[model samples]
Target: MADSITVRGLSADAGQTPLLRDVSFEVRAGEVVTLFGPSGAGKTTIAMAVAGLTRPGVSLDGTVEAPARTGYLPQQAAGTLNPARRVGHALGELVGLRVPRMTRAQRRARVTEVLRAVAFEGDLGPVLRRYPAEFSGGQRTRLALAQVLATRPDALVLDEPTTGLDAGRKTELAGHLGALARNGVALLVVTHDPDVVAALDTRLLRVHNGVVTPSEAPQPRPTGATRPSVSCSGSPAAELRTVSVHFGSANVLREADLALFPGETVGLAGASGAGKSTVARCLAGLEQPSRGTVLAGGRPLPPLRRRTRAQLARVQYVWQEAAPSFDPRRPVEVQVAATATRLRGVCPGEALAEAREELAELGLTPAQAARYPPGLSGGQLQRAALARALLARPEVLLCDEVTTGLDTNLATHLLGHIDAYQRRTGAAVLLISHDPHVLTGRANRVLTVENGQMVG
Candidate 1:
């Protein structure tokens, strides 16, 4: 069989900067090819190139041949779905377009089949009826995959497909991809998860700096390693009381409650789609509780739009996937500084200087920080998001899987910065992560969200 995908001398450059240097690879039908690397290592660039959706301002220099029938799961999984429509509508469009001859009933059946292939644990009824914003990161990843699989492409490229998934779910996804390969579909996977890379009989190519080579890079630093130690203060910095959120008929968060003490790292753990994000949005003022109150320092806090500048500055949130948080048109460093300047009335120069310092501590150099959001890697943007929130110097910081895209070393380094910042400023942190190791010694206390309720 002809190769499902081929890239010869694939190089990408953004003006004077090189993103991916002279990379060549091929994936045959029924093969699994993985591009494994550190964050900012150009994996997504190559994946984007192969999928024929290279970003603007980036020029490609080599030849790529992929099937007319191809599918791509973007690194920003949430971007794949139309936020206004129910997921069923999104899937039905693809099903109808890909199989124009199928009846509406047949298309619905096909959508259900694709959703089952991703192995979601519950009924497809609620998932299909709910809007994209209703799902968690991992669930969105699956939705994105289902969108891709709905077309039944000959070649599929997935960027960080296992992100936001629990350990068992990651393993399950890998096995599902393996099954897909066995059925003669080629797959190119870009990921930082070791378990994902280990599970496949993959043509493993390591990407470092801007080069792709066949040699392995250094192993990631394990979690529970040294990070400037954590310490907590007496009072609750932020708390959610009897909070409930509704999406149509879905009661996402039901009478949930959580408390964040100053100078502490609080970890929220749950299976994907268990309402962890609802809790984060409630605390961040992004979502208004349908019936309960969100309080900071024992006083009720309003929705984000209604919050005072001080309230906005006092509670900051970093997203799980930080790309959406940034403005693609502006330099990342400038945007990072905007939080400080806009929120605290700091002078532009001082805000920029503070952003530089915090970014430096998080391992982002001035040059990297100067690039636009697209110019930076997912991991780099994640750190920038953290820096932006920290620049606000909030009493309560909410990090939604802030290190999910980073490699071990950078993640460890970033964690250390959070620790040091907390020690110095007594900022309480709410960490939502699927990786148990990330919360092992990092979180001073742990909370669980089960069936839409918070349990300690």
Candidate 2:
């Protein structure tokens, strides 16, 4: 069988700085190729190049071609989809004209079919009508994948597809891709998950420091310091009692209760639409609960806005997609410094200094702060978002799928910083993730959600 994709002498650079150099590879029909690397290794760049998104500044001198139609999934699903369009409309736009055209009913049937293939069992009937904002992080991702698959493209290029999905959904998506490979559709998956690498019949390619090389051996598993225990004394940093969220007649989150004590690291695990993020939003005061109450430092949190500035300062949230959190027009330093000045009452110069220091601690150099968000890599953007959050020195940190697109090394390093910071400051951390490995040795406690309800 002919190869689905072929690349030779692939080199790309940003201005004079190289991003990917002399990279060459091929993905044969009925096969999957896995790309692994640290942050800024140009994994996403390669995907973008294949998808024809590379711009003029990104100098390229290589040939990458696909025999069959190509479908590309960007790293940030939230930004990829049109917020104004419904889920069904997005999928409709991806279906190829060569495919059998169908009526609205037939199209809806096809949408439901692909969603089922991806293990999304929610009431998509309603979801199909709602905008992107109505779906949770994981749900939006599944919808995006379903959109790509609707075209029945000969080649599927997924960039960090498993980032926000829970374990079950991850496995399901893997199965779908595996089946696609069996059907003679070439698969190129860019991911940091070892389990994903092991599950597919893949040729492992590692990208590091602007170099891409084939790996003779599989990547190593991540390791970290021993897990710490949370003491039962003192007031819990945050508490949710029978919290529930209803959105337009649908119960997105059922009555759920959770407690985060000082110095505790709690991991929230669940498949898509399992209500993990809804819980996080409720605690952060971003989403008000339909019933029940949230307490911080043993006192009721005034309705999100009524809460005192100090109360609001105690809890900070870092989202998985940091690009939207940042203003494209603003410099990273200005964005970080502005938050610090507002929350900590620090002068602009002092706040800028603090932001620079925090960025350095998060593995970024001071020079990086002068650049805008669009220039940074996915890993850099995530770290910068965390740095912005840390600038406030909040007592409680609620992280929603923060390490989704990072490579193993970068993910390990970032998680270590979070752990170290928690240990030193005793700030409560609520980590939401789909990777069991991430929760295994790092989280002090693990909570699983299913069907919008906490199972345990």
Candidate 3:
């Protein structure tokens, strides 16, 4: 097998703290290699090092060899996407950069090819005109992949490719990536999805606490967590009644009525681009609906900024994209503490203490919480985001795709924290996720969002 990418004696450290130590791996052409690990376990560090990348203040001593044409799909879609740019323009610009000599017509043709390759069925013009915010979580991921696919690289490194995909979409992506591997494209995927590992079975490497070693078998889906039961008999904590959300002319949610009962975990289940987050945003006061009302404790709730601090503190939302939620310039701990300080009116000193405790409960070390957003992995940042929200101690908690980036063990651990919080405060939790297993044992009842309506 022809080695498409190789790393020998790769070691990375941030100042004095080592992130990766003497890690080595190789991916051959027409083969797939999956890196498995928990969040902040040095998986992303190894992946980026192999792609010849390192953050500021992080030094690398690595001998990495890869094809000149290598496409990288980053874990955080926030950095990969430009909010101001249309999907077509972003992808077309990348195509021009990859193939500088291509004519305008050729670039357009190339954009169409990649769009179809990622998610679009036939005509991509409709999709090309929309912005990233208009798409669902899974669709935005596909748009990011299309940007990478436009480069036509010989080797591809994808981080958390299944972050926002449903089970059906995950299967489709697995088959698509498998096809790419079969067609002579070396694939080095950093993922926590067992299905992806099972589909891309050529090679497996387990990265643990900054060490990489060969994995003997495919990873398995998480199970066996003692799920908390929901036994709530009370009025709604947060309610969205006849809510209709629209972005420009596109209808996101139509007459979607959702209620979160006290001491209940409600799972919002839906396919890609089905407006699940919109329903959540309505309750959180993040998105002002085109019609209907959002209620907190049965009272009509207004948009954010206009609401009182108490209203803001009562309803908390942990968004799907965790990295962009924090300030990259400051330490993540300070940001997490600020949430409690500002929303709950706790003293800065006590809030910081509680932030540290909360972060630790979510599996992030006190040291990891002190680093900037860029230094932490995607899943680590997610737990940090949850900690930030939990510190507010809201009566209504809305978690949007919280466990998507986490490994099975880590996911279960994080879910356990939520379960603990719910039992302690009897808060209402609206968990928006694509995992069927998560919904099965955890949620008291599942609401399916399809065609802009909530049912069953």
Candidate 4:
């Protein structure tokens, strides 16, 4: 069988503007092909086009030839996974695509197999009973993969699959993808991370300015220098003292101790689901600790609901995945400016101006900012989220994978912006990221976590 996916003279348009033009690509059986490019360059749009999943306003101009069973894992998790549905149930539903009218026992067995393929372990019952909200970002991403793999597609297309995953999980996922390609499955990946490229025997295609072409190699990233130690003159800006957090019977965080001084950026490194996000949530008052204390400015911090406006304004959190955190009904520009207006007491006009300035620095144009979250690409949406968070000008910023979907140029620019802001305001920053490169020179100190405990 000649199982393959081919695109010729492909073009995609949104609201009369071309997002991708004259793009061409192919993925044959037992081959691995990667699309590498800067963010918002329409890499994801091409991926969606190939999978027959383009949005209503997107007009396709070229042919997308693929196998009957095509599995697609989109970059945005919000639209793909049902928040209300159990993870296992969602995977089970997708199983029907491959095995129509499957018996209950047969369906259960199939779901379990797919889950295991994604490195999900332990009892199937507990995993099936939990909602998507209960799982960490990496866990949710893996579950999404399982849902797609359950269909047993001959051609697998994934967009930013390693966005929120930890280093270990990324390696594991790369291994799985390599094994799948060896088994004669056609794999097409859209990503910017060189680490992903190092894991697979793949051909590189570059997407830029609405066009696609063959690339010799992945672009080299600029090296970041080590940051000099900054002096702390007063009380710590935020502190987590032997804090612990539990979800149901599972302990997600255990006796974790951390302190952030004014004007210093603290980088937290850990495997996905290793309590990094939980710590940030606790510090921002979004998640309550099961035990111990979270202090702000040397005082015990209250829960998010109990916190005052001033308290809330003192700390801000930028989510790992922007699309899920966004309000889909409104334009992203409005949401970004809302933070400044509500928290900083800036006029609506001034807030919008600041938002526009920040967006421009992150590579989003005025036109792109006018669109809603769903209309924007993954990189664009994540930049919008960062702009919104930075607009608050919080005393302590909790950024969880703020640069997950960004390209090197944009990521470097965003990091420089944050560093400049901290230097100007003497604010503390807790930057959580899977890439250690992000922490170099950016974070005053770096700490590692494993199995819910801080190792350094």
Candidate 5:
């Protein structure tokens, strides 16, 4: 079979600064290829170049031969779907694009067929009627995959396809990708997920310092290691009593109770749409609880809108969707430094300096932090979000899927910093993740949530 995509000494530069350099690779029919690297290493740039998308100031050099029929799955899964349109309707529209002469009935049939091909086992009628936000994280990912596949592309470029999925769902997705390759669909995956790398037998290329070279596949980190010692003394840092939250007609959380003692790490685990995110949002004051009370520093916390700046600064939230947390129009340096200005009364000059230092610690350079959300990669945005939260010196930190886009080496390094902060400041942390291994040794106590209930 002829090669589906080919790159010969391809280099990418954003204005005068280079992102990728001297990259050459090929993906033949029925082959899976991955570009693995640390955050801000230009993996996404290469993927975007392969998918024939251009960045604002980024220019591509050298030769890239791409097939006419191609599909692209972006890193931000939620952005792939239309929020206002029903799932089935959005999918049918895409099918219509590929099969322009097909009738409405024919389009619906094609949508259903594509959904089934992506292994969507849910009831088709109700699921199809729901909007994109109504779908769980895993379901949203599957729907995104279906959207890409509905176009009937010969090659697919997926960026961080396995992020936010649990072990089982990750395995299921890997199996699906493998089967797709077997059916002669070439796949070029850009990710840092070791599990995803291990699940596929493919050509591995590492991108770093604006270059790509052949490399061995990365290995997963060993779990159940020694955890940081935390002295959980005095009153709990934060507490939620029988919290209940509702969105429209959906009961996202029902009478859920949780407590975070100072210096303790608590893990929240659940299936996608099982209310893990709801709890985190409630704690962060982003989502209001319809019933029950929240306490911070052993006192009843005020309403989210009524909370004072001090109260708000005490609890910081690192969003699971990193890019959305930052303003797209403003440079990230201003946005990140603003946290310190509001919470600590620091001057802009001093706050910027602090933000720069923290961002550097997380592997982001000053130049990278100066870029807007649209210019930075997913991992860089995630790190910047963490830096903003840490700058506030919050007493309670709520991390929701913050490390999903990170490579293993950087993820481990970032976790070490969080552990150190918790130890030094006696801050309480509530970590929410779908990967069981992420919580294995880190969390002092693990709670399992199901159908809006804290089952364990």
Candidate 6:
């Protein structure tokens, strides 16, 4: 069979800076290829080039070809989906050309078929009618996958496809991808999840310093800290009491309770839709609870809008997608300093100094901090987001899958910074992640969430 995709001496760049250099690889029919690299390693850039989305000035050299049909799932599923469209509507649009001559009943049947293939079990009657905002992050991601699969493309390129999915959903999606490969679809996945990498017989490629090279072995996992839990003699830093969140009769999260004491780190794990993120949002005051209460430093959390600046400053959250967290039009220094100015009462000059210092701690140079979000790599933005949160020195930090899309080295590096920062400031940390490796030996305690309830 003809090669499903091929690249020979592929080099790509944005403006004067090279994004990927001297890369060569090929994907055969029914083969799965995995790309691994730190955040700015150009994994996504390569994926974009392969999918024919790279823009002018973002030049590409050498030969790159895919089959006539292709499907691409980007890192940001929510952004990829039209906010005004329902799940059914999105899928219909994707497969519309093929189904243009079909009846309404026939189109509905195809939509249901693809949703089932992607293992989506939500109420389609309502979910198909509602907009993307009505669905949770995980639901939107699944819908995005379903939309891609509906096209029946000959090749699939997924960029950080499993970043926001819960473990169960991750497994389900992996299984579907494996099945698609078995059916002769060329599969290219850009991911950081070990489980995703382990599931496929893959052609592994590693990208670094704007270059790509083949690799035989997977990246090594981090050896996490094995120390005893630190002492918390005073009041706990943050505590959640029977917190619950429900969306339109669907109980996304049950009465979940957790406590984070000073100088402690707690890792939250679960399958997709297990409510780990819901709990994080609730604790960060980004989402309100349907029932139950939350307390920080022994005081009840005031209404989110009514909370004092200091009270709000005590809890900071680093989101999974650091790009959206930033203002694309502003310089990184301005974005990072906004956090410090609002929460730390620091002037621009002092905040910039502190931001630079924090960025240095995360392995970024002062020069990188002067650029905008679009110019930074995946790892740089990840580090910058963490620096923004740390600049305020919040007593409790809520990390919601912050390292989901990062490569092994960068993920480990970022986690190390989080550990060091927690130790230095004696702050409490609630780390929400789907990767068990992240929690295996690092956390003081681990909580497994299943079907919206906390178990052990």
lDDT of each: 0.86, 0.81, 0.85, 0.86, 0.85, 0.80
Error of 3 at 435 (Å): 0.9
- For candidate 1, the per-residue lDDT at 439 reads 83
For residues 294-406, write the lDDT of model 1, one tens digit per residue: 99998999999999999999999887878888999999989999999999999999999999998888889888888889877788889999999998889999988888788
TM per candidate comes to: 0.95, 0.92, 0.95, 0.94, 0.93, 0.91
Query: On lDDT, who's better, 4 or 6?
Result: 4
What is candidate 4's CA lDDT for residue 48?
88
**Candidate 4 lDDT over residue span 54-131, tens digit each:** 865678898889888888988975357789998878888889877799999999999998888887767878889888
TM-score of 3: 0.95
After superposing candidate 6 on the true structure, give the runs of residues whose Cα lies further than 4 Å from its correct spot: 1-3, 55-57, 121-130, 134-136, 166-168, 219-227, 230-233
User: For candidate 2, lDDT tens digit of each residue in 346-410?
Assistant: 89999998999888887876656777777677778998998898888889999988887776677
- Per-residue lDDT of 1-456 in model 3, one digit per residue for the tens? 344998889888987898989888889999898898777888888778777787767898969998888888889854688889999889889899877999989999999988767656656777889988788778888888988888788999999877888877777787888888889999999988777777665588999978899986654655434246566556789998899998877788999888788999998899877899888888888889999999988788989979998899899999888988888899999999999999888999999999999988888887888999898889999999999999889999999999978888898899889989998998999989888767767887888999789988
Return whichever of 1 and 3 wins on lDDT: 1
For model 2, the superposed segments whose C-alpha errors exceed 4 Å read 1-3, 55-57, 96-101, 122-126, 217-228, 303-308
In model 4, what lDDT does residue 322 have?
A: 79
Candidate 2, poorest ten consecutive residues by summed lDDT: 217-226
Task: Kindly give the stretch of ten consecutive residues in candidate 3 with the minimal lDDT sum.
Answer: 218-227
Query: Cα lDDT for residue 1, model 6?
Result: 41
Per-residue lDDT of 325-408 in model 5, one digit per residue for the tens? Answer: 778889998899999999899999999999999888888877888988888988889889999999999999999887868877
